[model samples]
Target: MTSTAREAELLPAEDAATYAEWFACLAEPTRVRLLQAVAVAGSKSVGELTEQLGISQSTCSHHVRKLAEVGFVALNKQGTTTRVSINPACCTGLPHAADAVMGVLAPRPCCPDNLACDVTVRPLEAGDWSAVRRIYAEGIATGNATFETEVPTRRALESKWLPGHRWVAELEGEIAGWAAASQVSNRTCYAGVAETSVYVGDAFRERGVGKALLHKQVTAADTDGLWTLQTSIFPENRASLALHHSAGFRTVGFRERIAKHRGIWRDTVLLERRRSVESPE
Candidate 1:
């Protein structure tokens, strides 16, 4: 066992008093292993857990039962197999559990070595057209963002983006990402609403570029008196979902087969961030 595993074993004892049942349940090596497996799989059945961990079916069931007893795992009957998944509430309440577990299991950040570059959020500039085109080109190639046929020309895009609420993220003095809000509908009734979009260069993604762009767009829209800003994100794009949620966007609906890409239909989720009831001065 590595030092981390050894530490995991002993650390639970410190909180044993308040979490006696949980600690005691996790004390068993087999139960701990089962919990780890379930956490990794998101949700798993008894048989699937046994196969993944290379443990006996009966032993897997026993350890899973222990985990469930302590509230670390929840079991659901799925036909002949029992499906088990981590109880997020239980793990979240246990101090340091998330950090310790994720440190050992989660993938490292993509841009871990690039500390010198800082992402900057600011209003879009007059000459940011080239950078905006480059960002849009990258997003277009990915096939996950936007339905535009090709990167819009600088003059055309700037005419549309510059006049309305917009923001861009600069990385090391280069425009790496951009987001903007446009009127949702031309009718005067929808004047207080806008649809928002964000695009980031592939190289700068997962480096806080998207969030920075989104922050600027949201702030700019709020400042411009847009009461509600909305966006539709592809269901598979987890990063976009996280960005919108962090920016206070609430999921309002899901549209199935709203768009097609590469001969397949894509489902888009609608999200909106409303200006707080308290107005921005």
Candidate 2:
């Protein structure tokens, strides 16, 4: 680990209690199930959660209240029924908190993700899978770009990526690059808080294709109610680091030897950009 990465390992005294409280709130298995249920199934009444989770109404209500107290979920009363939903902000905040505690990242100062092609940016459609994967394979060919030695299957990418946030760029008529976001967590409160990936084809490098694709990705995320975006990059990939920096991402610090690529341990710089303005939606 480098000096910055080593120095970052200690948890700050001031934040200790807050992180502890956040973790404690989900200590119960029932509460965990409730959060996953709300996240996957959307907002639900206490009665609905009770039936879905196979718990009694009173028990369901009690756990929901507990989660709400720590900002994990929110409850709204509609006449006789109380609807429980995941907190939009906490969707990103809690995971960021955990990463900070583990010395893998720094606390937010505040935030913001993007790309291009003839250069046109549009939502990626089913027909674009081959092009997207081709671009992905090209990116993987660059040793510093990603850890994957082989391109992931389209079905694999589809299952891992969030819908609506996937985008592709075209130059003239050829797909030149792609960008997509993946869920950072399966927990309900973290819904829509995503980690982004942008890959440009070898032919499109340095052609402003990335910038165009990124613009579409972040704009779509904002309109879709995402408030935070995170990405990991190898320090050696200076162009990518610069692009993200220009897009408003701040370095959280080096996640030293975080993982292995090609049998060699690789260090990655963790970066996150929280939206400067909260999503109005």
Candidate 3:
């Protein structure tokens, strides 16, 4: 663990024990299959579970009971049939537990306070496309910034980014950098999770423009109800990695040669920040 991990909170022993129990309870392949079926099709009678999963009724009932014991599934009795439904909390709880076990959680400040004094961060505007593309082109030109060989078209970017999460930084009235977060998935289960990207113009590197943009981006995400933000950077991009770390992102993994760029395979350092979101459940 780095100083950051020492400074950051670790998963509590009790929580870890509970997560272990949850994990252990689903260790059987049949139970995993049963849980998936219930989650996908809403409530299911034991007969429906048995038929859909092609298992015997006794086996289905046994596995459903195991899942219920760990609170992963709920059982209801309607008439003589027992209806099994996935727990609403499991939608969030399972992913959170995985993050906890992997030590990918980030309980940090809303944003870094040491934001660039000379930079002003603001919501991206329609007319900012020209400058935004120019800055994006700068990032694309740096082969290490992304796997993209060319800057994305404005329409393409606009459609991809979450509307309110797009932001830009102005240094001396010029666009110096930009930051945005996009949905990690369209599924409702992952509605509050996003993948983040920060790009600083080449000339603005080391001027704190990246941090300034990130300060606004992350804090806005927290206020806007994002629970987790993640990004991947090439291992060689130390400056970008440092800027993200200042914003409290932790390296979750080192993806070995995860993709190719310019005919060469490249490794990426996966980083993530988890904002503690209040659960309606």
Candidate 4:
């Protein structure tokens, strides 16, 4: 009907009808704003959405219904309030929108070119703890990696890496990053879940060392039958957050004032990635 809608119809056809519906649903400025709000707030009820966006209840309900009609949202009645969540299927299909939005917003890649540094990822060994500890300590000294007061000894660090779950990144024979999974909880019920930790040397930050280590660690953990991998990250750690997000972890929730650091309370965000027997492409 509209030029934009016609253009959307002519675009590639991975899911033509679905994309048409999504395009029609998103064509409205109000609806686009509403979806942006929901993406930022995770989920919201009609009343909450209205209050936040300064729209009337009927208007908010109308836009939400349009979103649901296009399969972009799901509504659950919670007594007098209705809760809405972004449909995972639709959310996963939104990369086109993301790219378009980025074209207008960022317009430039954050890291356009890769570093020329030589790096390698391999199975971590017991003998590597000294180098690992030193790298980790350097990260700690910069206040960017961990909250641990002191670096662990070789035995202490080795005890944490369970069989079938160890990987490290090396740069010119020096350990740059390491990642391993530990039992999520002492309780047996949580045995299938494990919490993962990754640390990269300060000198190797943003050089792809963390990404390499995560790929190897996640692959090993998945092969070992770990169903869920989790981590707690300080809210201020943007690089670590980007690494986990790129590796497919989703932010589940946040804990307020979970730890005290540098004489101030710090919040931690919880992130998790579900691993299946099938490897990721």
Kindly indicate the candidate among 2 and 3 with the higher lDDT: 3
Residue pairs with colliding backbones in model 1 are none
Tell how far residue 95 is off in model 1, in angstroms.
33
Candidate 4 overall lDDT versus native: 0.75
Sorted on lDDT, highest at the top, how do the candidates line up? 3, 2, 4, 1
Q: Rate the local accuracy (lDDT) of all candidates.
A: 0.75, 0.83, 0.87, 0.75
Candidate 3 Cα misplacement greater than 4 A, ranges: 1-107, 277-281
Query: lDDT, candidate 2, residue 99?
Result: 68
Instruction: Please state the error at residue 149 of candidate 1 in Å.
Output: 3.4
Candidate 2 stretches with Cα past 4 Å from truth are 1-117
For model 2, residues 39-75, the per-residue Cα lDDT tens digits are: 8766899999999888889899999999999888889
Q: What ranking of all candidate models by TM-score puts the best one first? A: 3, 2, 4, 1
Worst 10 residues of 4 by lDDT: 103-112
Q: How many steric overlaps does candidate 4 have?
A: 0
Model 1 RMSD, rounded to 1 decimal: 11.0
Residue-wise lDDT of candidate 3 within 1-281, one digit each (tens)?
47877655767789979998999998899999998998998788999989988989998999999999999999999899999998999988998889777755646565578776899988999888898999888888878899998888988998999999999899988888889999999999999899999998888888888888888887788888888899999988999898888787888789998999988999999998878555221
Best lDDT goes to which candidate?
3
Best by TM-score: 3
TM-scores for the candidates: 0.56, 0.59, 0.63, 0.59
